[model samples]
Target: MAKYVLTGTYCPDVLEKRAPYREAHLGRLAGLKAAGKVITIGPTRDLTRVFGVYETDSEAEARELIESDPYWQHQIWTSYELFEWIQAF
Candidate 1:
């Protein structure tokens, strides 16, 4: 499997709107982690950005996870980017 990094920038004032959907968003991540698909996931300390490193067979699978996120569906995220990562170390 290859690794991919998914990054997201939260929308302005999203903190207020995220409460209701936070659990579901986290639940999705938890499922991935449990399945060993997620390597690491978390928000930046300032909460402006979030990132997750995932291991999947293809880039499409990684993109699917990001698109399926509740944050993406509800527009809690204002911007997103995905990149294939080669962890040399």
Candidate 2:
């Protein structure tokens, strides 16, 4: 597996917009976490962006995971970029 970094931009008024879907979103992530697919994930201090680390066999798998997220499906997350990461430590 390779490490991937995912940085996502939130839609405007994200705090209010994400409410209904938050529970489902977090629940899904929790499942991925338990499965060892997600390393760590959270929003930035300003909540303008969501950042996460994932371990997957390929970038396609990572992209699929992100695209399947409730946040993405609902537009709570407007856009995202995923990159393969080489952890130095």
Candidate 3:
């Protein structure tokens, strides 16, 4: 399995809209965690962005996961970045 880091930037003035979608967003992460695909996930302290580390078959698979997220679909996440990561620990 390869490791990936995914980053999401919150949409402008969309926290209110994001509330309704938060549960499903979390549920998706939980499902990924249960499947052993997610290493860790959470929003930044300022709530401006969310980040996750995941183990997946490939970078494309990781990209698929993020693109399919409800948060992305609903436009709660305005931008994203996915990168292969090397965990030194």
Best by lDDT: 2
* Model 1 C-alpha lDDT per residue in residues 1-89, reported as the tens digit of each score: 99999898987777898999999999998999999889998888888998889999999998888888898899887788989999999
Higher-TM-score candidate of 1 and 2: 2
Cα lDDT tens digits for candidate 2, 1-89: 99999998999999999999999999999999999999999999999999999999999999999999999999999999999999999
Go through the candidates in order and give the C-alpha RMSD of each one to the true structure.
Answer: 1.0, 0.6, 1.1
Model 3 segments more than 4 A misplaced: none
Clashes of 2: 0
What does the lDDT come to for candidate 3? 0.89
Worst 10 residues of 2 by lDDT: 41-50
Evaluated against the true structure, the overall lDDT of model 1 is 0.89
Candidate 3 per-residue C-alpha lDDT over 1-89 given as tens digits, one digit per residue, 9 for 90 to 100: 99999888988766688888889988989999999999998788887898989899999898888889888999888898988999898
Q: Which ranges of candidate 1 are over 4 A from the true structure?
A: none
